[model samples]
Target chain A: MSTGRKYLLQNVAPYGGERTTVLLADGVIAAIGTDVTDDDATIIDGRGLVLLPGLVDLHTHLREPGREDAETIRTGTRAAALGGFTAVHAMANTTPTQDTAGVVEQVWSLGREAGWADVHPIGAVTVGLEGERLAELGAMAESKAQVRVFSDDGKCVHDPVLMRRALEYVKAFDGVVAQHAQEPRLTEGAQMHEGIVSAELGLAGWPAVAEEAIIARDVLLAEHVGSRLHVCHLSTAGSVEIIRWAKSRGIDVTAEVTPHHLILTDELARGYDPTFKVNPPLRTQRDVEAVRAGLADGTIDIVATDHAPHTREDKDCEWAAAAFGMTGLETALSVVQETMVDTGRLTWADVARVLSETPARIGRVSDHGRPIAVGEPANLVLVDPAARRVINPDEQATKSGNSPFRGRDLSGCVVATFLRGRATVMGGASCDEDVVARA
Target chain B: MKHLLSTGSLSHKQAVRILDTAGQMAATQAREIKKLPTLRGRTVVNLFFEDSTRTRISFETAAKRLSADVINFSAKGSSVSKGESLKDTALTLQAMGADAVVIRHHASGAPHTLAHSGWTNGAVINAGDGTHQHPTQALLDAYTLRRHLTGGGDPSGRDLAGLRVAIVGDVLHSRVARSNVQLLHTLGADVTLVAPPTLLPVGVEAWPAEVSYHLDEVIDTKPDAIMMLRVQRERMSSSGGGFFPSPLEYTRGYGLDARRLAAMPDHAIVLHPGPMNRGLEISADAADSPRAVIVEQVANGVAVRMAVLYLLLSGNESNETKVDA
Candidate 1:
């Protein structure tokens, strides 16, 4: 058995008691107490720093295999670690996607080799993400990959029977189906969030009810099957009510709100910049506040970075021609800190709960979302909560530089991240060279 | 001259300048020999990706009036339907020694793409893009509105100040509505958008126009012009059921029928970017009524487009020469 190097973080705030020293050995926290005398141990000062459990993301599009130029397992995982995330549920909307055990296992193995962050490969609920028929859910679940989440994320599973069957089938294996929640028929040629701006701009409007209707139906289907369902990036105020009603009825449903969805609104679409374009598009400020309130009150359970990356060719044209997605992994934590924490809607503890703890619990990742203590897995982050900086997409570590938050000033920054006693990021920068060398 | 894509960006002064120039063009149309030598050396291409008879011919007429050689490129009989890409067609047009390409594509921003894509160095005019701004349509509508409401007193030189306009119906699918809203606002008209909530695009609060669920509320404000948008049935298939519930329900709630037409102020005119759903958006009686100005809007379209072409192409000659020098 290899004994991991011991390091102590003294005076970690808001979680472990003041002046507590956390000791790590063999990937787990070995001790936490007032004093521990070890002459050979390396002690690091941690005063005025908040020790947070490693973040987990339920939605991240790691464009791999075919579209590696946009994002790869190596670059995207490094981005995740830099954003304070220790594990991310890699979406199955890749080229030759995670629709089968073979593909899922390949992505899983690539993530293991990358070794920057834990990549939990999400299997596609339908073959080719076509929304026509179910993929080999059981095979993916039982394979060496062990994908417990099934999703047709980029495309909506619009067929009711197919949705119901997927909902019912996933119950057998205790797997939760995460839905992208858009009615394709209603949103055909839909460019932006359907509202006054769409009317004014004369772009095709994508109605909120298109998304709300899907969530309403899926939540009811999950309730009927007595299964768990995770709603991905709930955007509208109407969606909040549906999810609130679902949770009130104890339907075993959890919802996630994206960092972009919580902060950005449809007003940005007026400029016709493709960077603002996204799926379940940015809605009104009323919807933004509702989503924030949802996050605060637990109506929304997680802050998933729907970190979709698109090539510049896909996004640099007219508003209608641009692909729907924006790079979110690197900016997710800062946005949450700005929109939720600095605004008094949530504290650092709430930020930790939403960004890290709740998402890990929802995805059923056991080693993740552990408390920062002895005997716990040393997956953690150090945050500089008072740090203020402007977002520069060119400076982001993600392969794609399509962040709409580019050039906007944001509060708070992630200083370092430790994944299983490994410092994957330090001093607000990704330790990519070391990880690549290790890999 | 580049094609007028969407009126959403035209200022009052710019709109007036275009309309005044169109008035000058209209004077030429009235002459026995209706042609000009200004664009005799230029070639104009009418690239219609969607079905259109009135818009295409108006553009063709406008080009001929300017004495430009006109090439009609309809998508139905062309290689576009066979998937011979837009770039290929542009190259083909370029090979034919085409000077300016006037393209009306079903895809929004298609003309903008063609112009900026270096597909052709010739001036590109947007006939229309998918539910996006139609600059010429808004200009002509403004011209017609100015002529009817202002009684031909050179309303071209002035913005629609002290004017209140209510735009009704299918705001979501109507590029005309989008262009009119922006152009009218820029020209100083207080605009209101009246449609079913489903017909309004997603984020409407940020729009300059006030949104109302009913047209009666808009009429209560006694608008200067009540522009009715044609409700394309294809939008129903895309938007799903209950877009208006029924044509009868739409007529009752939002349509500018004879009864609703009577409710408008006598000075207020009815505008439509034609091929009107006669029984749906407006009654046959109301459409032909003296207050309609629907036919006049069409006549104004040719003149306005002529002015846009002449100004954009001719007005930039000095700048082009400077660059060449």
Candidate 2:
């Protein structure tokens, strides 16, 4: 762990509750309530700030150890801190593919050296994400990173026997296989969502059944094997229905929705802008409404950033030619607040549950997603709920300018972020600039 | 209009104005000189990211006949691997001071991206985009239909209010079908799309055109015109050959044959945006028939493209035609 500093937060609402004083020292919540005083602490007047446990992302692409031109652990974690995330599960689809224990540990160590957020490296389920044979899941789970999550995110593990074997095998290590639900043959040359918009746009349609079919098949497979199954980036309405049905059947499946899907729709693709182009491409407004309702209820368990970053060269061309992703780490919280909180679909406490607590619980992170009590780890974020800012991708810490939310005004801002009593971000920017730069 | 990207966005007034301008441009082509100085000193770039010698030469001939400088830039490959090439090519065209860019790309929406990207100030004309829109092709087809079906050969200020047109074959991948369905509907013509179920898009019912699975059914109706789309054999292998069972089976189902040709009205014209698959989508008897306007469609394509270049480059769009054809 990096060296931490003492801090005093005065009159901040924990989980948007009554204002109270909290003290941090020795990388833990040393004291709380009135009379919590420390002379050697940096005093913060947190008026009108809603404090909550720091956000933990179940899905984030650091793009480190490869594709550093887009993002690295250092930049990605800094962006996470700015977005109020204290921990992030880096996806397995990197250059060399984070399948082995050595690679996951390397990524974990890079996150430690960055010191912005605690990086949990997710191991790949398939070797090189090829889906031909399983990777060393047992070894990676036992490694230093202790990867409990295994996934072939960019490519789906389509082979039923392989998926079944993976589902059955990961149970030995209490690991969950996060599936990127896509049927390859059904989505051949798919550019965007298969709908009226795609019909007119002339781009090949990515039918909802393509995702639903795999999700349906995998959920049944998971049930038959009786192992943990996690679905990534559930976009379509039919997908929500399937997951709801799976959950109703008491199947051990948990699903996540991205920030982009909550508000943006396939109508955005009418402009043919590649920035809106994503895998499991943005669905219609009806799908958007369905996902919002799903998340509002407990049907969708968590909200993951899926914070993919791509350089301008990848996104500045025709829709068919562009890469499939958007940068989300920086604007994730603000988007959640605008879509979930401000819309009355969720409260601040629910925000903490979906964005921080639930994700941490799902990822089996013990230190994070803890209550703001005395002697707990001080991984926290102070957000000004009334504050708002237009998202500018250039101003983001991530090296990519492919933010789909660029130029849109979003509510709430991270006033400060604390990672174990250390201010990774203060005054809406990275704290300890010189120290961070050197580290 | 700043750009002719898609016919779906074209208003009735804009569509007619273009057809009228094309009619005047067609009259000019009848002259012995067959040249115009309307777009003189203008630089028109024929940017072909997909190789279509027919489209490139047609655009080239149109630009040259208008006395505009035409530069052909062909960068052929999958747009997926040629992502940066499109942007780089656009920037290069911007640097070269192109006044109008006639683009034909393998990727759908490539022309839309170019027109709105702020990379160049040129007016973009879609020669054809990936199964998306070929606005000029649709325009020339409308011009052809109007000349033969409407107000004799001098169809000015008239739209095909009640003309029935049946567009056959590969509606799923034909940029021609997509563009024509929209433009024809805008011009008040009823369009029936006849194709195999596998060859039609999922949401094609939402389009303005009515759909038919039987070519003989549409041919039995004695539509004013039948436009046969090019059926690429590569689609057979690429789409798992699931689009149809065999060439003979497809011809038996949707092909415009000699018997189907004889069933049509005597005045009903035949249209094909060629390099025709003579024995595939259309047989030789139908393609070479006296009623077929396939060759005339090519000559009209030049006039239609010239009108587009003239209207766009002459700064006289959204107004009456000012040139004497």
Candidate 3:
């Protein structure tokens, strides 16, 4: 392990400022912009590297405890580290269903033992994801994992009563209810985003209103109950507008747009390929512009990679029958760089705040998304901002190859990722860490 | 064509070829023996992931009439844990050496998946897939419409040029409605989609058709034909804020009853892709009427499917000369 060893990162620029030297030692930042006197310490050449706080994914589906064929904490966090994420909130939709305190603790521990990244468990809002009754929210909130986020991702909390109650219950422990905002009845048998493309393709349409309506309702409910509400994977322009309006009114609401949603649109579904099929399906270019404007203006709070992983069977099939997500952990940063930073829609400082600080705040992961200062934990990533590469699925870190952005040339390759001073990834290669064997 | 996934993409020339070929297949069915030696050595598979006895039998008959070996595999009950059934089923069909796979799945784009996934070297014919499309059904409907309009002749070079078609009821969830609207438009027909404001999709205005809520107004237009789409009871509580008050209300407003049928043009016809709802979308009186042509649509389904199978599988690879023992 690279822990306990001093390192000098020379002439690297952090997201907000000019180039400066950052010293890492004893699992924390020893100094920034100062010459160190450790003669035996390592020296890392960061002349051309752009450093950012380690990416924190508020939404990730590390399919563990069951369905490990797709992804596990060990591989998933490694992929996360490759994408420059030091912490990821594992969603509650697992085989046993991460609804209880016990399940969340197990997932949290698995991530800890993996030693690649910190994995905070998101408790399920409803038991078994049935949406009929509430899960033990208080128990999960007080569990060993200290799950501060609760969501029934993949399945929407459709019932107004259930949604309001979930929003209310989570507020007691300062937990935020991350809602997958979709109206179930409207989206029944829905294949893709309802629009001109769906009309032409003849596939059943998942209208933008299905997501917007729920968000409109939830924001009101959150205000009524005086609680914080987080919207997951906000896709449509109408959704962004509603969230913006709610935020303007001072409703305790924050919204996130996934990296896939930021760049991709519904036109990709023209080929009838299942790879493009996702929940809150991709919308039109007009909606895409609206979301981009929303993100640039800070109406949308953060960039989340609803990083769902599915096996080939789950994705390489009919669009309607396919699973509803893309593997985003390894490709999120590149996507953001191409769509946001490269487009001049957002700066590296904006990227830092959205990808790390804001998400960590939403998930209540205080330890992961800290500033690049002396005495702070060394959770950071080094990016060759000028480098570009076409994404190859075979070279991906995820077990699944369903990267929706396959073959697209994207810039900003992650060269190294450090989790509390230990380099999980160094120079684009994984550093060998003594991961605990399965007990 | 490698696949007949949807009528949405089928060109006017290709559609006319299928129709003209069906004219020949329909002639074969009128003969004493419907069997042919054209596909004697070929193998065709009917991979149905959805339960549709009518469509399954129609395709099976189409392949058998051409003397091709047929394999009927129903993957109805399998381990559908995250859509593995489709992949496993597709791989099995690939290994079975089936020359063509006629697939009918509940999901909207299964045939497109089967064709483009490269799981098989065979051709793909979409029988019906979710609410997305049913190209064969549209072909048969077009075949029936053309035959009824101008008396049985070669529609090889013809399009439904001056024909006006009104597709009534549940346009939101009806694959039949979607496929017909596209195919009919491509054939140079003017289509008016008649539905409750709720039944039509949000972006129907973008489709190559005009929309109307009143069936009587559509009937008053004296259209060349009125095609009634099947209305599902489940869609009432869902799609568009409760589409209708009740089944009776829907039948009264849009149902093709005797009065509405009488309002159509004298030479006009009525088409329904069944199993019919009895008195729901179309009344029993109208369905049993001589002008209905619903039965003829079923009979033409076989012929259209035969034409699709023949065109897909009867390339130069066929022996073309086989002895009848």
Task: State TM-scores per candidate.
Answer: 0.82, 0.97, 0.92
Q: How far does residue B68 in candidate 1 sit from its true spot (Å)?
A: 7.3
Candidate 3 per-residue C-alpha lDDT over A1-439 given as tens digits, one digit per residue, 9 for 90 to 100: 3446667788888993698888888888888874554666678889889999999999999999798999989989888999999999999999899999999999999998998899999999999999999999999989999989999999899999999898888878999999998888888878888888887677878988889999999999999999999999999988988988998899999999998888888999978888888887988888888888999999998999998888987777777667888889988999888888899999999999999999999999887789888898888999988989898877988888888878988888998888888788888977775632221
Tens-place lDDT digits, model 1, residues A1-439: 2235555655556342365666656777777776754556656666767778989999999988679989999899999998889999999999897899999999988888888888999999999999889999999998887888889998998899998899889877778899999998888888888777776666777889999999999899888878899999999999999999988898999999999998899889866677899998999999999999999898999899999998876775656667899988888988988888888888778888898898888777888998776688888887777788999989888989899888899987887777787778877887756554373
DockQ of each: 0.33, 0.79, 0.51
Model 3 has an lDDT value of 0.86
In terms of TM-score, which candidate is strongest? 2
lDDT by residue for model 1 (B145-200), tens: 77777656555476677688888988877788878888888878888999998787
**Interface DockQ of candidate 1:** 0.33
Which ten contiguous residues of candidate 1 chain A have the minimum total lDDT? A10-19
Model 2 ranges with Cα > 4 A deviation: A1-4, A434-439, B77-81, B316-325
Residue by residue across A1-439, what tens digits does model 2's lDDT show? 4355689999999999889999998889999986778898889998999999999999999998789999999999999999999999999999889999999999999988888999999999999999999999999999999999999997899999999999999999889999999999998889999978888889999999999999999999999999999999999999999999999999999999999999899889989999999987899999999999999998999999889999888898888888999989888898889999999999889989999998898788889999889989999999999998998989989989999998999999999999988888999988875565443
Order of quality (TM-score): 2, 3, 1
lDDT of each: 0.82, 0.90, 0.86
